[model samples]
Target chain A: MKLFQDKISSAASRVRIALALKGLDVEREAIGILGPDALNRKPEYLQLNPQGLVPALLTDEGVLLTQSLAIIEYLDERYPEPPLLPGKLEDRAFARTVALAIAADIHPLLPPRVTAHLGMIGVKAEDIAEWSRHWIRVGLTAVEELLARRQTGQYVAGDAPSMADICLFPQAINAERAGLPLDQWPRIAAVVARLREIPAFADNGPAPRS
Target chain B: MKLFQDKISSAASRVRIALALKGLDVEREAIGILGPDALNRKPEYLQLNPQGLVPALLTDEGVLLTQSLAIIEYLDERYPEPPLLPGKLEDRAFARTVALAIAADIHPLLPPRVTAHLGMIGVKAEDIAEWSRHWIRVGLTAVEELLARRQTGQYVAGDAPSMADICLFPQAINAERAGLPLDQWPRIAAVVARLREIPAFADNGPAPRS
Candidate 1:
């Protein structure tokens, strides 16, 4: 299996964490997106991911999986040794809810491309920072609320670190990068504290791009 | 089950279409979001959906499922009459990849709240339109490329209408709403045309608020 990834990307990091948790060995090719950005848009790379989004996984069967959640879930399904999603239906729903809360709400806002577009469209650089911080805070607040729910365990959704934690830990890392304080969202902070101590999350996360 | 939704929301409409396709009767409540900012921020509604996004489903089991993909997948798993995900594993990945093309990429860009934020941050109204049109075109262009691939079926991933069609149809609708011509994406237009003919897509979609 091959993963085309950006070392610091929350989406890519989410998948990296999953591969770690699942104990899947894969090759990683760093696609230089933080630079001028057309590296991902080239014909060959675009063929792998039409959207040109980073962290696409090419399975050994030759099928390409995009979207962090889809790839993570695919890995969990294929390797089923440790389930990243909860067993019960409601628990699964909550786990997905929390995962998407970060994946959709927080990460999209702070992506370099989005921020660059904001600058092009006349948003001041300082205001763009404000925008990123605001949305990150909003997303983390929601994460806090969800984490505080009765379903909460040591991780975000259940006893084991599930897909919810896989997605959230990366967003929390990005939130700190965006200068949003995690201390305000104590439950979210608590969950991240627990997740960071785990080997899978700690070993394969947000390392400088090589 | 009940769905809290906005009549014209692309994400909400995606879930509504899935519910219809699944032959599940659902009570729909129009959440007034276009008027005031953050109707989704209400304490009552936020209790059910902390992220304040619409199309949250309250199952008879009293579980709240947010995020259109999460809700749709939960319903599909529970009902299992007509599967929305393909039977083959690789085919399922493609279905989800297409869904996220719209869900994660397109819909987040055109949402009212995001545009409103742009306006507040000094992006001209016309510039916001330009921004929306630009991103919608980017997303649909990506969709067109993926649809044009060899895996092309009458629907997105295969012969049957799946979650890809559910997410894609609403996005096609929203692209038009953003004032971008859909003709440039002929393959996408053709697939959406086929899916719209189905009873579920025809029966329940972005009808004006009651």
Candidate 2:
């Protein structure tokens, strides 16, 4: 198995943590997305992922998985020893709700395209920052609501580290990188710090790409 | 079970068909998204779905599942008499590959905010059209590639009305709504047309909501 990844990508980091949690050994290659190589746009890489996106995993059976969520689910299914999801259906649903909150709402707005496009629309940088802060706050508020309803365990899904924790960690890392205010989102920030203390999450995360 | 949905959204329509296929009775409320009683912005609705998005499901057990894909999967699991996923894992992954191509990628880019924001940037409408078409063509090409590899049957999966068909039906309808040329995407169009012939895909679909 092999993984074509970007060290700085939140999506790639999600999968890296999964692999580490699962104890799977995948041949890893880091593609410098912004450098001269432009490896992600290369023909060979595009063949692996038509979307030309990072964090494409090549399974030993030769199937390539694209979406980070799908790939992580696949990993969990194939290796169920240390599960990434809760057992009960409702618990699974709760965990997925938290994950999708990040994937669908928060992450989509983070890419530079969103802010850069707003800049072209006569929206000032301050306006963009406010918009970013507003949405992140909305997402964190929803996450807080979810957390409040659950038992305060060691992880997002009860005491075990599940997919919800996997999803939240990267977004928290990116939120700090984006300079979104963390003071107001203490519950979420606390979860972030808690996740980092776990060896699997801390060790598997990608080193900063220079 | 009940579905809170609007008549115009393809995402909502996709869930409608899933419910219809499962032969489940769901209390249907047609929300007027632009009216005085817009269900989406209501505090109660927001409490149920903090994302303030449409197509939120109130399951029989009273749990609210917000994301469309997540809702569909929950229904599939709870009502397994008629499966909405393929038998094999590879085929299931292929179904998801097709589904997310539209759900995550194409549908997101086609939203009005995306084009309107681009228009604000002095981007020509033609360029925005080209950009929309670029993603459409790319996504369709990947679907075609997956189709070419799989055995042709009644649907994107073996011979069943699975999530892939459920996802594609709405997306193809939305593509037409977006006015993208279909001639260049014959295989995808063929699958779209074939799936529509099934009553579950046709009758339950969102009629063009302009």
Candidate 3:
């Protein structure tokens, strides 16, 4: 099994944290998603992941799978020793739903493609950053409200960090990087702080964007 | 089971198709996601789903679940006889990856929040529409490339429609509704045409945006 990842990728980092939490070892290669190597844009890489996105996991069966959530869920299902999803059906649904809040709603908006589009349309870099800040704050605010509910505990789901925490931690790092203050959401700040201390989540720290 | 959905919601339409495919008899409540009813914005609705998004499904166990894809996956998992995901682990991952290309990459940008943000910044309606069209086309182009690969069958994955088809069909409808042309991606257009002919996907047609 092998995983092609760019350390700086928000989606790739989610996979790294989940792998660490699961204590699963696989061959890892850091490929540039957008720079000189830009391996992700190559035809060969595109053959594996047609979307040309970072973090494509080739399972033991040799099937190349794209999508961070899908790959992480695959890992969890394959290696059940430390399941990332809750055992109870409802709890599992909750974990996944909140995870989607970040993965689906927030992260996609801040990718290079969107930023590049903003630039092409004459949006200044600072203005682009402002745009990022706005979307990140709005998405995180939704997460904060969800976390304020009784369902969120030490982690985003139960005592343990499930898919919810795995997905949220990277985005929280992104929020901080984008200069969006987290003070507005104390509950989220608390959860992120706790998550950062975990060896699994911390081992694959967010790589500074070059 | 009860589902709170908006007729015009792309995400909600995904669940509607999936539920119909599973043949689950779910009680439906049509809530305005944008107008005065904007049930998703109400405090009571927020209590049920902190994200305040449409298509929140309350399970028989009374657990409220959000995120259209998550809700559909839950339905698929619970009702496994006619699985929305492939039986093979690898196949399931592929289906999910293509599905995320739409759910994560495409759908979020066209949501009211993003468009509303554009308007807040003095972006004209035409500019916003152009922005939405550009993103949708880029995302669909990626999907089209993936579908062009030999791996894709009659549907996005196999002959029968899986999660990938279910998610892609709704977004294709949205693209067309938004005045984006699909001729550029013949493979995707063909698959979408086949999917729309299916009873499950056809039952919930796209409602004109108010």
Candidate 4:
């Protein structure tokens, strides 16, 4: 497999973590999503991924996959040894619920393109920061509350790290980066700390954007 | 099964379509997400769903499911006569990719909370409309291009209305609501027209916000 990704993309980070958890090796191609030579804007990359986003995976069968959650799900299904999703139907739903809470509700609001759009719309930088922090706080607080209500083990869903934890780690990093520390959500902070102990999650921390 | 939802919620509409497709019936409870009498803001509703989002499902097994996609997946698993996802792994991934492109990327930007935040930050109503239209255009155009590249048969993924179509219908409605017509994406418009013929998709169209 060949993966097209940017270092700082949280979505891509999720896929990278999944690959590592699956113990699979793939050729990595770094794509610039920022600056003058942004590869995601290039015609070739756009042709491969119409969304022109980072973290597209080309399977050995030559199928091109976009959308990080979809790619991670593909990986989990294709390589099912250490499944990213839980075995039980209800547990899996809970895991995905937590994942979507971050992916759909929180992370989308704070991406570079979104903040840049806010800037273009004449939103002050401070307000944009506040906007990012506000969603992060609201979303993460909900996740923390959800976790508190559940009988959580080491991870978001159960004893093992599942899709929920995969989604959580990146957004927690996003929170810290946005100046909203994980201290606000102690359960999330503890779960993230446990995730950091794993090499797959630890090694794939978001790299500095070039 | 019991579902907590609002008539105008696109997310809830996705679940409604899924349930209808599966030929299942659920008890529905109306929850206001907007205005002063918003049920989602009430202590009881928030206790039930910390995210305070619509389309939460309580299953026969007494499991509480949040997140529309997750709930749909659970329903598909627990009642598998007709799967919402495609059979093949790659095809299933593609279906989910299309779903998340809208679920995680486009729809999040147009929700009432998001637009309200923009307004609170002093964006004019016209600008907010443009903002909604801008994301709808960009995201749906990408879906159009993706469908154009594939051998789509009546739907976004295939002849069957999978998860992809479930997501597309509501978002296309959103595009129309934002004053951006579907004439811009012929393929999506065609698919949506076909989806409208199905009572599952047609009847669950975002009801007028009460």
Question: Candidate 4 on B13-61: residue-level lDDT in tens?
Answer: 9999999999999999988888744654568877777667798998888
Q: Second chain TM-score per prediction? A: 0.92, 0.86, 0.93, 0.95
Lowest summed lDDT window (length 10), candidate 1 chain B: B201-210
What residue runs in model 2 are displaced by over 4 Å at the alpha carbon? A35-41, A112-137, A149-152, A206-210, B34-41, B112-138, B145-154
- Per-residue lDDT tens digits for candidate 4, residues A1-210, read 999988999988999999999999999988778764565457887777767788899999999998989998999889997999889898999999999999999988988889889999989999998999999999998899879876458899999999899999988887887778798789999999999999999988777554
Q: Report the candidate with higher TM-score, 1 versus 2.
A: 1
Report the C-alpha lDDT of model 3 over B187-209, residue by residue, as the tens digit.
98888888878999988755778
Instruction: Provide TM-scores for the models.
Output: 0.94, 0.86, 0.92, 0.97
DockQ of each candidate relative to the true complex? 0.66, 0.35, 0.66, 0.85
Model 2 root mean square deviation, Cα atoms: 3.4
Reference interface contacts recovered per candidate: 0.61, 0.20, 0.65, 0.89
Candidate 2 has a DockQ of 0.35
* Candidate 2: tens digits of C-alpha lDDT, residues A62-171: 88777787788778878897998888776787777677767665666554545665565466777777666665766777777777665357677677888888988887
RMSD of each: 2.2, 3.4, 2.3, 1.5
Candidate 3, overall lDDT? 0.82
After TM-score superposition, the amount by which residue A10's alpha carbon in candidate 2 deviates from its true location, in angstroms, is 1.2
TM-score of the second chain, cand. 1: 0.92
For candidate 1, give the lDDT of residue A59. Answer: 92
The lDDT per prediction is 0.81, 0.73, 0.82, 0.88
> TM-score winner among the candidates?
4
